[model samples]
Target: MDSQTGTHDDNMKPATKKSLRGFAAMDPQRQREIASLGGRAAHQSGHAHEFTSEEARAAGKKRHARAQATGESPRA
Candidate 1:
């Protein structure tokens, strides 16, 4: 039973066991190494974009304006 929600434990569905496949199966260190390799490859191939401070500020301002107009929260 959930003390806060006042729900009976038996009414809840039992948790199922799931096998972690592909990237999800990897350990954190292995994942970081794989991601690092991809990032390095992208930069070496000139496919990666590094934003300037001014550009980042402009993008943030634009995002804020769009969010304000749409009555949605701005992303951090």
Candidate 2:
């Protein structure tokens, strides 16, 4: 059960604009370990989406637009 929502935990709710919990709260080594597991799973499952040059450009544009709209400078 999710304490915040008081319901069975699922990802229906969007993440908060800011978070200091879960993997974000974990130490760097722990975060890397978790991220590595995710990458490995994606490879094993053959469901990872790879961006081509054009797709990457479009995705970058979308990300930058969101950041600018939020008054945030995009991180490198």
Candidate 3:
């Protein structure tokens, strides 16, 4: 992060930044497109997990139970 501006540093040299960029500088649509492509590639490469229907349902039920018990968002 930039100290004076209190913002992420986006003015990095090309050599330093060739592999990554300040995500805040990316347009939302472009970010989504890139993220979607990465997700598809991960699944194609067998590197990403896909939940079974039963697993998803169980997870959702657990989340709801947690929320009910805590009175806060399950995600929190």
Candidate 4:
């Protein structure tokens, strides 16, 4: 379960395995509001730290190596 939003556990399920039927059931305005609220919340929580392009590339390489060793992609 998503502790942050009380939504279904998307992390536990593969993206391709999930259906968008429920997502389409929601109001577009409501969805936009929810996404905007989440973005603001994340910004307020100091979660959007800055990372230079070089740093990001280095991190990606390290993450790829780790994923290869563990047989799983690294989480965002």
Q: All candidates' lDDT scores?
A: 0.94, 0.86, 0.87, 0.84
Native RMSD of candidate 1 (Å) = 3.9
Order of candidates by TM-score, top first? 1, 3, 2, 4
For candidate 1, the TM-score is 0.75
- Per-residue error (Å), model 3, residue 45: 1.7
lDDT tens string, model 2, 26-71? 9999999989999999989998888899998998899999999998
Q: Clash number for every model? A: 0, 0, 0, 0
- Tell me the lDDT of model 1 at 58: 100
| Whole-model alpha-carbon lDDT for candidate 4 | 0.84
* Model 3, span 1-76: residue lDDT tens: 6779877767764455555568767999989999999999999999999899999999999999989998998778
Q: Mind giving the per-residue lDDT tens digits that candidate 1 earns over 1-76?
A: 6999977788688779999999999999999999999999999999999999999999999999999999999974
How many residue pairs of model 4 clash at the backbone? 0
Q: Candidate 2 regions off by >4 Å?
A: 1-25, 60-76
Where does the lowest 10-residue lDDT sum fall in candidate 3? 12-21
The C-alpha RMSD of each candidate to the native structure, in angstroms, is 3.9, 12.8, 9.5, 14.6
TM-score of each: 0.75, 0.42, 0.57, 0.40
Least lDDT summed over 10 consecutive residues: which range in candidate 2? 8-17
Best first by lDDT, ranked: 1, 3, 2, 4
